[model samples]
Target: MTATVVVGAGISGLSAAHQLATETSDTIIVCDAAPRLGGKLHRLALDDPADLDQGPDLVDGRCGDPALPFTVDVGAESMLARRPEGLELITALGLDDHRVHPTTARAQAFLDGRITPLPPSNMGVPTDLEALGGFLSDAGLRRARAEVDHEAPALAGDVSIGSYVADRFGDEVTDRLLEPMLGGVYAGQSRRLSFEAVHPGLFAAARQGGSLLAAAQQVAAAAKRSNDQSVGSAPPVFAGLIGGVSGVITALEDDLRSRGVAIRSSTTVREIRREPGVDHGGRFTLVTGPVPAPELITADRVVLATPAAPTARLLRALAPEAATALAEIPYASMAVITFVLADAELSGSGLLVPPGELPTIKAFTYSSNKWDWIADRAAAGFGAGTAVVRASVGRFGEEQLLQVDDHELARRTLAEARAVPGWQSARPLRTRVQRWGGGLPQYLVGHRDRIQTIRSAVAAVGGIAVAGAYLDGVGLPSCIAAARRAVADL
Candidate 1:
């Protein structure tokens, strides 16, 4: 007779619901504001030619550029082959072939800005030592290099990512490394992000290295080890489905439904009221939004896995203090414009701008060169023998860009990409713009503290739990982790 209700059909929600749904003795009901699941992780067709899976890049571009002529994955291009969860999910679904490797680069973060090259290790990180070497005078380079103390600093005490980076490297390095990395990954700002939260491994490595540089390198080396394992011989990179990440969602949803899970899409949850006086258990009073209003439905437990804003709103109705902290957690807006190209000449993975080059785009996946399938499908959707390329643009909070009409946005993104080193002479066949106004959650400095406070209040208030990219971390893997643990607690 015990039932659990999960709010939001996002990856986080879906992952948590999947566990609870299949668990013995507990029936589950999942609610989402949209008419479908997948949340921000979705893909669409390119002018009806083929579906374009979009979101942050997942699959690696190692197989070949997407513009070549073959199939490419849409979801994660190349997952950490080291991690079992993603692999397990793929295997259980009979998608073992979907799993591929990647081809990494020697000179990463190669941009036209004043960024110090991300130090060796993390994909998105640039280093002050490298930057100093790249831009400073001989004396400056020598001074900075000489300061390389083999001692690693303890990253235990709390600090903001920005403060930590600036203190360890320099303001310039932090701006380039901490800023763009966070922007590219979470659309967050280091100035407001918690050091421990943003770079847990970095902090942990520092604690272990006994010196900041050594710790940074240690973290980098561990990641490097993982990456090496992912691609034993081939170049280390990845790419995914030709249509889009939506393919993955489509497959998963179909599988879940076949298993008899009730998928009530567009069923907005207006509130999640916990039963009074229940410590570990409670009844959830669910109210679908104003439209398609369903009579109140009750449940023994509730799971919240939506974005911070909406989740915060609902939680506020039940717990005020928890709501405040959740509300305070900021989000970054974004937009994606996939451009179909006229030929394979302009095909290849795109470039990542340093913090200041354009301040808008963190980077673009050269879909053509990133995947063979995408590349081989040249111009199928466009003119015969043509090509397809996607231009993803905008920083998280560029309000003006956020408000841009699709046409203008498309034009701007194409123009921006063309301005890159080699694309100066190319022309775009067509453009498709997808807007995500409040999509990315910014993990500002002290975010961990804020989340801690929110969780404490939720526990004190009644039977409730918070789960999503915001609570634990962003990205597909992280979302899955957060959801599984929350629902298991039910």
Candidate 2:
């Protein structure tokens, strides 16, 4: 009997197994349905000429050595530095010195048919009305400013972020500001997302019956004060490993293997059932592998660290209530198109495209400009004129948009990307498109209540716990935190 069985080999599951390895001398085994261990944390290699699929000869030795491959993250590229879990994990895995932060490049937003600096805000909620002048119309700006005088009644229960923000600052603020900001994270419409779940700090303030603008200001001020009071220079908002964020997964995998933990990829946990009156070796039995001749593994404890759908399915028999709640959580699909260009010169870290403002493209990250390492590596690997750029496509409820073949999708993305100012002259050397179906979980209205119900149901089932991006947030730090909490609960 396995002492502990972790179903799912994503960052959350791996982190849980890591925690379990340190806490108990149990026979731990991690299983993932996907062929690869790192679920969304994938690192793509850009070395093979066949993978290029287009553009000039990258293998030519004129620019740099042809032997070395240029690597970049295709999934999650960076983790939040403000959250300690990601950084702490890095340090614990002896990867502290390899940590890197984004350069001091201001992000820009394409508004009103032109590019402009993104205004200061606390996650899309404009703390200062003056900053909205560049994007918001005169009347829209007045409406946002008028929020100070409006009587904000105490918020009762949960509501969509778009509904509440529009009620206070008008529809323009929701469309022009909040939509793109929230879209970048959840890839979901703000009108359908939960206010309490998305912005808890503002939600807590709103429950007290006060001006939202004032609440935003106070929150921003408190954040500034906290940063200012920190020991040395203020920490960056995000951090990535020097090689790639996927390094964390590789490191964790190695560490777990060294400790005698078993990781099984391409192995699906078809079902999990509670054993009756079995308390000696294990209490749960897991059915896995091919349906023709399934294998059973018994475990004393289990951690369900998969996405909403899979987790819900596995918990159907074990915890029906939790399964039902988990099924209610929806996910969004997206694609990231990475381009290596020759003689390209782009400014700023990236550009955000509000919904309806662009076709096929949601955002563009001038990765070579944002990360000095990418630039240095590009020059050393490809040539002095090479630049790396990533374009994000698709959003919540936009699955049909990504149905096209990779070549077609890349074509559409590249065409739209070139239309943006400063990117027109870019000559593509190579292009790769990575599609993530139902990658990000959406936090819809009443998400807080749903989470509570799921947690309550899971807690009642002895020796079982659930952890994933859907529980708290869709960030690396959040997943890590959830994993730790799940282990603690077990």
Candidate 3:
């Protein structure tokens, strides 16, 4: 049987391999440049391994207490509960029972030197103007009101979310509200992000007519009607696993192995050469090796589920047009600093900082307060006095912040935490900094058309498909859906 090769072992690649294993008779082999699986779904243990006293049972003060291992996910932390793809995969992997939802969905907005409750928003578009009087100036509120009274601008095709929103509501709304929420997810500036790609339903609503805020209200009303159904009320907005999101990776790997899928790690593919009208019709030659040694693996079908840049490089030979389009897709690097802090009264799930407000930290998650699983682990491993909090630092144009050493980054993150209420005097017991080089993909304007062109070029090459956070939505559900669709195309 001819083997099908997947060239990345991220959730997308693993999901593709798993789907192909079930749907097709073709042999599947997954390869990755990294030494371990779970590209971004990485977890770190809290206790020191070298300390003899620090075993799995290393609780801070209890001898016979439940010795649960304390681990913090440094990568993708949560999945959208409403998106069925991720949950479906979890159920298929027998991990549906381990699913968890946030205890508190509330979040704070740290802006203008104070932390206040984030008002109800439709993807960062505030529904209530009067409530926002504290944050917005009289002039800003007037501009926002003018958006509804003024005729909607003619948006023929895809446009940058920032530009469109700024034009509609004013720069204040885009910078103060939309940018933070969009930036927290994509790490890309809103001015460059595709409005259609990021917010499709809202985009459709906007196209109908009226202001952006009016569009949001209309879209939200329709959503409310849909949420009246059985499926919508079942799950929360976000959910995680009992252990960590990494559990999904482990489960996927085990399932793939059970189905006889060969997983190759620490193997980098130098190039992929498509051989047409050759032996057995056609096949792909994956030039893979560590160094000083080269190995060629032939595959009847190939899947490129890598990041934007590397994927572009691999496609340079087979499909230059696709490579060019892929090359234009840029990425942002970031660091997640996990701090073990003393138990403080931190309500709400997390806080998002407005852009240009903080130099180091962009977002903060009160892990223990947000997730019951994390809280239980913290109580079992350390005691009620201990808490877990993490701050995400770095954005698209903020590469300089990541240049400093991890120690300095952590120090800066802790200092930013002081801006949050009740965290002023909090000190971190242990600090763990995870640096992700080229972590998040930026979905700039024209991203949808570019993705279409890239897909068309790759499709012309035949027997090859590309899937990643760049093409699909930048979330676990979106990636899972993209991976499934990529494999189905074969």
Candidate 4:
């Protein structure tokens, strides 16, 4: 029997292995550098309220009960339901009944020292300018209204999102509106991010040379029409499991184990080399483990489901051009601070903080208010007056802000949360801080072209393919889609 090796046991690699197992008879093996399996899809168990004083590290297993009532996702909380990959995988794992959607509560944005309702927008590009009265200043609103009059030729090539939006609307729109939305998703800077990679629909519309306001309105109308035409009342924009999004990883792991796939952790692939004139058993040899005594594994096929830097290192000798292109991709680091508060009620689902508006936190998610399951679990676990909230900090080029220890980080984030309009009286019961260093990949200008170059070079090398959040999109579904494509390519 032939064998295949998948490096990096994140969602992408695991998904690839599952596909290969289901379709072919190849002996599958997955290896990850970290001791844990799940990459960004991490669920942290909250200590029982009785053990609050013990500390964050003393989890439920050590304290009161192993089955903690409240467990929250520190990475991604939801997946885009519009994409079929995530939902299909969930269904395949027999988790359809466990699926849940966010409540009707809308999100808010903190601007000018006040929390205001977020206007109807296509990714922060306001579709309804009339709704932005209080959100924008008088002069800023006028400039935004004058977007139709600004005449310009069709877009020639890729450009930064901030530059394009500011040219059409104004600086305020980019700063107050666009920056916060993009930051929440990528922890990246708007001016440095690519327009083509971030907003492909808007980029295509801009290529025709017309009013962007009108283009945004048309796009929103198209989306509404598509939803109305669906078989039933339109599906929710996002979906999550009853317990946490990390439950998907758990279910996936169980399914993989049943298929007889080998899952190994704390085993890093140091390098990959292709042997010339070898065609019988396997051509690619994977060097893994420590430099002192590295272990070698042979495979007929290989899938690289890792971040840009490590992927570059592995492909340096085999595909230098691809490695060089992958190395150019940059990454951003951020931290998520989860707080369990007693005797407090938050109004909206969450509030986003534009850069410079707050000291550290860029956004806050009222988890108890957003998901019914979380509310029920929190009330049952702790008490009726308890609540759960998550505050996100750091951004691209803002590594210094996260250099402090966890205690200092949590203290700073909680202090800012109290200053928010409705959270002044929140008393912290338990707090957990999760830092993801070099977590998100930044799609700089001409990112599409760079991706093309990397893919072409890797294809030329043969017997190997790359998949990650950096390729197509940063969402869970996108990573899965990239993994499936890599499997198909092989």
Task: List, residue by residue over 198-287, the lDDT tens digit for candidate 4.
Answer: 988888877788988888888878777787687456769999998898888888889988999999899999989877787533479999
lDDT on C-alpha atoms for all candidate structures: 0.61, 0.87, 0.82, 0.87
For lDDT, candidate 1 versus 2, the one ahead is 2
Every candidate's CA RMSD: 5.8, 2.2, 3.3, 2.6
Task: State how far residue 489 of model 1 sits from its true place (Å).
Answer: 2.0
lDDT of 2 by residue, 27-136 (tens): 99999999989888998876544444643322232333568766899988999998889999999899998899999997898877789888888788888889889688
Rank the models by TM-score, top first: 2, 4, 3, 1
Candidate 2 displacement at residue 16 in angstroms: 0.4
TM per prediction: 0.83, 0.96, 0.94, 0.96
Q: Which ten residues in a row are the worst by lDDT in model 2? A: 55-64
- Where is model 2 more than 4 Å wrong at Cα? 55-64, 279-282
Give the Å error, residue 381, model 2: 1.6
Candidate 1: residue 61 lDDT (0-100): 17
Over 369-445, each residue of candidate 1 has an lDDT whose tens digit, in order, gives: 55555555644434454445554455655666556656556556666665565555554544456667777777776
lDDT of 3 by residue, 240-343 (tens): 98878878999999999999999999989888886656743389889898557889999989999999889999999888999999999888999888876664
TM value for model 1 = 0.83
Clash totals in order: 70, 0, 0, 0
Decoy 2 TM-score against native: 0.96
